[model samples]
Target: MDIRQYIDSTYLKTPAMAGTTIKENNEVVRSLVNEAVANGYKLVMVRPEMVAFVKRLLCVEKSKVLIGTVIDFPEGEGMLFKKLDEANKSIYDGADELDFVIDYKAFKRRDFEKVKTDVIECTRLCLDHKKIAKWIIEVAALSDKEIISITALVKNVVLTYFSESDYFNVFVKSSTGFYKTESGKPNGATIHSVKLMLENSFPLPVKAAGGIRNYEDAVQMIRLGVKRIGTSSASEIIAGEQVSDEY
Candidate 1:
């Protein structure tokens, strides 16, 4: 299971931690990101408000430490313009990447066109700010048919979203840490979804999120061809713990 070859040298230099909340206090977020940077972690996936603070702290060497934040967030209920505005503001505040949750309600209702439009709009905003956009499809909630359908739509959207990046990324997240009444605990990363996504051969990368806690599961994900992983337990995983990173 040695991933020394697949492991990007920069990845170990700067592991990513998705704070996963737009409502968390700014001071707390700042403290966590600061501590992570001090501990050799390079990237922080924060909410919009904390992006600037992390930027100031991490941008010291003019290297501009990579920063990422969510757009359209855990719940994709905002207007398209609002999402775009938030994305622009985040990038202006020093965010390097944008992770957006495509409106699941719209997708569930089979509003494929709307979903495609949403991706296009969000991607445009990110690119306008020189930021990368990674779509969150919430793959755990989708049925097999829905997965296939959304995958097709996202592939089309990625092609049309931008031409600069030959392949755009769409993450397969389990849950947003909220609205998990049915699953009880957070919806975890699944091998089935990864296999399905791989089988379809989409050009975009798949980031596995929601329940990864330890290096083992992280390694498992890497073996599944998941290029990126989203977890709050990044610190713990780096510490060698087999648990969820949501605390």
Candidate 2:
């Protein structure tokens, strides 16, 4: 397989961790974009604010790597309008794909209608704008049944509103790689959770994110039919080394 094409070489660090200043954060994102362009990775995932910077840089460098950004990231409990605002800003800044964090808390509370509204609105925005929409389910925060239910819910929405020709533009992604978890728990993608997502959300693509840190793991996910793998360790994975970074 052309593993590079399956990889979304990612850098979603907040400015606090990267640096307190915008310039400092851009430097970090610039390095990631540079690496992705040099290696011909599928996409460079970043924060919404950094999307324009990445777009400008790629335009200047004549790079073809796509730009992706997150919405209602890490936590999906934000107000629906605010999330829509964020997504619209990212799309305005030239993001090619949007990874949205679904409100699993609402789903857990059995607020299926609220969950459906959140997904459908954000997904509609993406589809209308001609961008890819990926729903991050944060699998580690869910029970097996919840995972299945949420995946099926997303699939139903996609099938209801979009044609088969648009299926590739939507995905049920696995995680944000930043959710808090109890002690001794894995807080990212696992084979079991990915299997559940794939089984339930088929016809819509699946993206395996979080906790995938090595070449073998990525290959395994691809073999399982994951269309994309999100990681900060894309270089190491492509080089066949064990990735040390957690996200």
Candidate 3:
């Protein structure tokens, strides 16, 4: 399979997260954007602030690499309006795809209704703007049962509110790749969790994000039917080498 099309070449770490200056962090973003242009990546996932820059750069190069940005980021705890505002701004800033971290904390609090509304309204905003929308369920933060339920929840919400034609534009993604875990546990996609997501979010597509560190892992996820693979190590993976697995 041509894994390049399925790869969402990602670089979402902020200056603080990367322990670098703002200029230095932005240089990395710019380089990633340039690399995407050179390598024919399907998309480049950047922070909201970098969307316009990436867009202009791609436009200059006449590159078809789609721009994706995260909404409410590693913490999906923002209120519904806050999430929508972030997403709207990202779209306005030239983001072709918005990966919204679901309000999974609310779901864990048993606030299923809030989660439903958040998903529906946020997705509506994306469709209205003619942009792709992805829901990051943060698999590392969820139990197996929660993974199943949340994936199905996103599928139902999308199917109920969006037409069948829009199904491909929406995806239920696996994680943020930034979650902290006890005992050095994986904070990204695992085969088991991905399988659960695939089983539950079928027909709506699944994006296995977070811990895809090598070509083998990406291929495995694709074989399991995930439509997209989000990772910060796209180059190393394509090179058949080990990736340090930064987000």
Candidate 4:
């Protein structure tokens, strides 16, 4: 596999999040965008505010690197309208794909109705705009049964509301790369979690994000059927090396 094509070259940390100065953070985002464009990675994931800036960079270079931004990010508890507003703004800012963090907390609370509405609205927004949509179901926060249930929930939502032609554009993404967990447990994508997602969300591709720090792990995800990988370690992975930066 040409692993580069499967990468969602990512850097979602803000200045405060990374404890860096704003200039430093901008440089990091710029460098990541340039590197992704140079490497021809499938996409470059960034914060919603940076989507337009990244789009301008790609436009200047005439690059094909798709621009992806998160909606309602690490926390998916934003009111439905808030999430839609954020997604609409990002889409207007030239995002090619929007990875919306599903209201997993609601799902955990057994509010499947809320989860269904979240999926229906966000997924439809993306599909209507002819852009890729990914639903991030923060796996670290859920149990095995919850993971299975949530994945199936997304699959059913898309398959039920959207046409088959739209299936490929909708994805059940694994994490936001920003989920907090107790005791430093794996807070990002795990084989077990991703496996459940793939088994349940088949046909709608899965994008495994967060905590995937090495080439072996990236390839393993692909081998297990993930259509995309969102990671901060794309360069190291391309160089076939492992690094210890948790996304």
All candidates' lDDT scores?
Answer: 0.64, 0.91, 0.91, 0.90
The total number of steric clashes, by the backbone 3 Å criterion, in model 1 comes to: 1
Tens-place lDDT digits, model 2, residues 50-162: 89989999999998899999999878899999999999999999999999999999999999998899988999999999999999999998999999999999999989977
Q: In model 1, where do residues sit more than 4 Å from their true spots?
A: 1-24, 39-42, 61-64, 164-175, 181-186, 245-247
Write candidate 4's Cα lDDT for 1-247 as tens digits. 5799999999998899889998898889899999998898999999998898889988999999999999998889988999999999999999999999988889988999988998899888998899999999999899999999999999998889999999999998888877678897998899989999999998899999887888889989999999999999899989988878776
TM-score of each: 0.81, 0.97, 0.97, 0.97
RMSD of each: 5.4, 1.2, 1.0, 1.0
Model 1 lDDT tens row, 39-131: 544456777766787788776634434677877777786788889889889888988877788787899987767788888888777666666
The RMSD (Cα, Å) of candidate 4 is 1.0
Worst 10 residues of 1 by lDDT: 6-15
TM-score, prediction 2: 0.97
Q: What would you estimate as the lDDT of candidate 4? A: 0.90
Q: Alpha-carbon error at 240 in model 4, in Å?
A: 1.2
Clashing pairs in 3: none
- Winner of 1 and 3 under TM-score: 3
- What RMSD value applies to candidate 2? 1.2
